[model samples]
Target: MTNTMWVRGVEWLAAAAADPRACKREWDHGEGVALLEAGRFWDVLSVPERLGLLTLDLLWRPGLPVPGPTLVDTAAGRVGFLLPPDPSGGWVGSGLRCASRGSWVAVPPPYRPARYLEWLVPPDGSGTLHGPGALEDALQQANGTLAVLAPLCGR
Candidate 1:
């Protein structure tokens, strides 16, 4: 990531940590680990649908450099990462109880695409490559595409 993107990511992460609802934790398997979790994290996203997709996509993306998780306090709730039972399998919220973590925790498979991908792509501060925009005008688009997909999905 570019320095600007890294700074932006750090700023966002820091803001997330500051939220009242944020929760922080650490995990170890003879190694060190950290995670962040937020029950109401959707509030941080400009678009809920995009937030869902971006989150799932980031978790599911292949070969991502997995950052050690961390925790932060935030207005909405606590946010932190939990260790996966099998590190290779990635993270999922399948049967995650509001406050449960560790071996007993049930999680979804990693390969499945999230249900929210049909919604608008979240803006990385607003750009075609980062957010959705009209090709001709190149203007940034703000609305989530959920409305368009909802009727089709009969939601």
Candidate 2:
């Protein structure tokens, strides 16, 4: 990547950091990843990888809206979607998790892959995020589809 493109990517990813300068410093020092505190610029909602992938597909359908930055932790088999800070706590049950108020997420540095984390949907740096309602709907639909397909897939 050219310097301009790399800078742009970093500019967007910096929105997630508790200290954008610290994040940039780590990357500048050759770190591939940083631990970003949640609930500072955004929160996170994570689901099992299978369900999250399906949810992403639904969210990206032609008539639907694309979600904000998303990350998948290959080692942990989890997918996390960034949401606006202080998301609805009602969505906390049913194997779903919301990382806010003190939680942290392992994030890759801008367009690059980290140890076990990669961006599924990179942020645009425009402060856009997944709406709680839309995410919930898509997740429910994905969960239902997975439940139906599990037996047929023999999983």
lDDT of 1 at 57: 42
lDDT of each: 0.27, 0.81
- How many clashing pairs per prediction, in order? 30, 0
What ranges in model 1 sit over 4 Å off?
19-37, 43-155
What is the TM-score of each predicted model, taking all chains together?
A: 0.23, 0.87
RMSD of 2: 2.4
Q: Write the per-residue lDDT of candidate 1 for residues 26-117, one digit (tens) a residue.
A: 11121121233332221111113343333434443458433222222232232223222232332233322232222221111111112221
34-119 per-residue lDDT for model 2 (tens digits): 88888877888889999999999899888666677788989988999988887455566577888897897778876678788888
| Residue 3 C-alpha lDDT in model 2 | 65
